[model samples]
Target chain A: MADPFLSIQHVRKSFGATTVVQDFNLDVEPGEFVSFLGPSGCGKTTVLRMVAGFEEPSAGKIVVAGKDITRLKPNQRNVGMVFQAYALFPNLTVAQNIAFGLKVAGMPKADTDRRVAEMLDIIKLPQMGDRYPYQLSGGQQQRVALARAIAPKPKLLLLDEPLSALDAKVRVSLREEIRSIQKKLGITTIFVTHDQEEALSISDRIAVMYGGKAEQVGTPFEIYNRPATKFVANFVGTLNVLEGTVTDAASGKVKVSTQEVSLKGKLNGSKSGDTLSLALRPEAISLGRQPGRDSSLSGEISEVHFLGSVIRVRVGIGGNTVSLDTFNSPATPPPAVGEKAEISFSSGDMLVLH
Target chain B: MKSGRFWAWVVFVLGAAYFFIPLIATVEFSMRMRRGAYSFDAYQIVLGDPRFQATFMYSVIAAIFTIILGVLIVVPAAYWIRLRLPQLRPVVEFITLLPLVIPAIVIVFGYIRMYGSNSPLPFLGSDTGTNSLLVIGYATLALPYMYRAVDTGLRTIDVRTLTEAAQILGAGWGTIITRIILPNVLIAVLSGAFLTFAIVIGEFTMASLLNRPAFGPYLQNIGANRAYEPAALAIIAFVITWGCMSLIQILSRFAPRSSNRPN
Candidate 1:
């Protein structure tokens, strides 16, 4: 592809002897919303800060729009950032805070006012121009912070866990609002968050990070379904692992519990009698026998959880327990605990861990 | 709850009486200047005196200078310590508190010994130098209060993030300090300034030793010679200090509220 809008090439950061980010690299397209999703201390925020020019990379380059801005000052880089805590100027009114960059750049008063008003309208807080940051709620303050960051028409937008501090209901709605605003502005944005659902819901692409490295970078469906690494599979969604032994290396047949299932190219070259770990999503398994399910296993019901919409059931089979989710229905009662149960899943759903 | 509130009121009333009784007596005695009946003659005399105006205006000018010098010294020092040398905070705090720990008389004596006419600095050799020395002395006395106020203000706002924000907005160091940081801490610095003003107005030891015509020295000179005027001066001094404190209270109401949300 023709040069990506923002390219982070081999960026490495170290503090004293401990390296926080090692050889981190990514290419973001223009107007693309990419999320750096990882747990805390995974170097996701460190990478974001490097992009924003707050922290200098120990090695490598950050090029934006064909310009190498690795050494440029944060202001000169023209990147907007929303901090985890709303870093709104406490002394300035909402309008003044939004107009700070414009004022500093010597934009005319009329133009500055017009731009500030435009940003306020974009964040859906047009009437709050006269309010101080302290007077607004947490969500409102963050929205104002968003407005302030974008008022300067920055080249890139960086959000560092912007919604982590909000309530659950607000977090859901605000994430939607942020995605829509990012689309409307079409600003190349990088979001750093640990919430898997948040990343999957809003991002056009996600870079799942672990141990200061990007383990996988793909669309949400690809990251969740075809997780390249064991870490990605375990981190993105709920998973169940079953220990098995390969019966035939040539035919890729593995014996899981008392059931002998055909792996058929899922196993990555395991020899006969070698132990292999297999993984499956909780939703991939059914409570009872189903048509077209080529693989089946019998077990006893261990525990049942009524989760309102989906009932989670744990089944004990051959010294191993596998969890599966079945839809909760009033017409059909869930299987009782200690009842013998037969679970079935498609052979294609099994992921043989490398 | 009722008894708790009742006892609270009782304690408050007792404290108020204990504090205000002496002030009331001073005022009543000052008003007893003209005759058996109360009159404004003492106020009139004190206000009309040319010596009083000269010395009071001198002290006011000196207080203003002291405030400027204090801000120039303390604000940058506090900001630097916070930004660059955070490890030096305890050391800097100890140094700032030295003025409070070391008595004013001893410090002024040290200044005299070190900066005498025969010494290399020779701050006492001329009137202007001596006046400057007095302003410096007042600033030293006010250092503890001024530094603490500004340091507290810095704590409310994240100094590192604020600096980065300003820098990204294309603000130079000068603009950041003058427009951004200073304005954010203006209320804190003003409170400190008012306190410095109060301290300098009634400061007697430094001015007396330095041979300046400050308000404190003038008050003492009048007290030694006259009886009623001394009480009158005391009341006036109290009013001036009260005015400074009232100004601080009003300014605090206008300070920028910290945006930290309640948990």
Candidate 2:
């Protein structure tokens, strides 16, 4: 296997009584974009800060390119960081901002100017060099910040919610821009974000953290479809959990009981009558017109929400709400509120998780 | 509404006049050298005097020394105190405000006893032992105002960003402080320096207690020995202070509209 470009070994951080990060370990390959996905205060940013040398780890070591960089100061680490606030120098023009890192590294004036011009070209803001950060929009400022951070050509780029300051459209577009730029430069990047869609869209792998620990780390598809922990499953996307009990033990199959019917699930160890939770994705459950459906439980339609491209149908199953989504089709009529409906799904969709 | 604004302006002008009347009277009285003969003799004599020049130079040297050392010492202390040692902030801020709380004579007397000759420490050794000690004293006195400017400057910019950005660019603390921080806070430093200069020029108690040659002694000498010259000297000092302040105002206006220097 190729050597890991960045090795974070069992890093931990604590503030007084609370642990911000615990036993966090991740290895990023060269030219890979990995995302730390979590809600606020979940230590995703803390890990990024540690890698950037802004925060020191209480325990463990960080190695970059085979070098132990745990104790090195931020400036000594040869890493670029873009903050959520778009912390651009208001006193410097866009070109000067891009050249700040080069200047700090004592690059010659001619070379600095060349690199700055190249940075502007790469960020696609070549003509806006003379404008100050205050003169630009939020998206423009973020681009300048990105350019400034990447201009030094550091091996690792750490982005902390870099696109969060922009509006929705700009946020999406700039994140795309950032992803393209990362690919173009072939730089190993660690992006910290709370947005699940962004993490799923732009990363080679995502480490979903909870309670200061990485709950799961896998490719975006695996993370979304096969989360390892309940935290990861619930945090990464909307999930509907149903109360159930195992009713079989052999042949790697078990029956999960709801109120009116038993749902089939793949379980190898669980015996009959053992309490468990039935984890199901909203898109996995299919609603139909059949009554007392075959191997499918029936529920009353509680609410129908028109969500533009897809419609959300909330069904009351055994006094618990279970949501299912369908693509917005004029031919596919939504179930009326309080109407009886049967929800069915293939055995592959039923996740026997506790 | 416009008439109310006009009335408010009238009241403000009246209040301003009330404050400047005494200063104007003093200056006019100084000009009436011979009780009817409006002559330039007082200013000429004061200008020609070797003692006045010497005292003025002393004050200038003391002010320059204070500005340099104060910036050197306080900027880092305030920066670190504000950024890193946040818990020690209140105590550090209170220490800087010591001069404003205690009387000047009380503090200067303590200084003389502690640092003057015959004292156990001999910090200053003699009356004329070290003008450097007097500058330290001046910096101590100017701390409250000067530190405020630098502190405010540090606040306006993203201190963490500057440090992190500088570090990522291969800049150590020395480079970050001098090239990044110092230039960004130049206006604040200038404002502090101007205030220090004014305080040092008019500071009578410290210079007198120390028996040091400074502008305050010259003013005192003129006030006691010559009548008209004191008025002229006061006017000169006022003009110098006013000129320095106005220059700062213009420079502050010329400052970038952005709270932080963007790069």
Total clashing pairs for each candidate: 1, 10
Regions of model 2 farther than 4 Å from truth? A249-265, A289-295, A331-333, B1-10, B34-41, B116-129, B256-263
lDDT for each residue of candidate 1 in B60-179, tens digit (9 for 90 to 100): 999999999999999989988998799999999999999989999999999999999999999999999999999999999999999999998888788877777676666677777887
lDDT, residue A262, candidate 1: 90
TM-score of each: 0.94, 0.93
Candidate 1: residue B223 Cα off by (Å): 1.7
Residues A1-354 of candidate 1: C-alpha lDDT, one tens digit per residue: 778999999999999999999999899999999999999999999999898888999999999999999999887888888888877777889999899888988999999999999999998999999998889988998898888888888899999999999999989989999999999999999999999999999999999999999999999999999898989998999999999999998888888887888988876667899998889898899988999888888999999999999898999989779999998889999889999999999989988777
Give the clashing pairs for model 2: A75-B167, A89-B261, A89-B262, A89-B263, A90-B261, A90-B262, A91-B261, A91-B262, A92-B262, A97-B263
lDDT of 2 by residue, A8-100 (tens): 999999988888999999999999999999988899999999999888999999999999999998888889889888877666789988988
Instruction: Please provide, for model 2 over B1-263, each residue's C-alpha lDDT reduced to its tens digit, 9 standing for 90 to 100.
Output: 99999999999999999989989887788788876777778888888999989889989988998999999998888777866787997888898898899878887888877776777768677545557678878998999989888988787777777767777777888877887777777788889989999999999998888778888987987799877898889889989999999988888865543533432
The worst-scoring run of ten residues by lDDT in candidate 1 chain B lies at: B254-263
Best by TM-score: 1
- The interface RMSD values of the models, given in order, are 2.1, 3.0
lDDT of 2 at B249: 88
Candidate 1: docking tier? medium
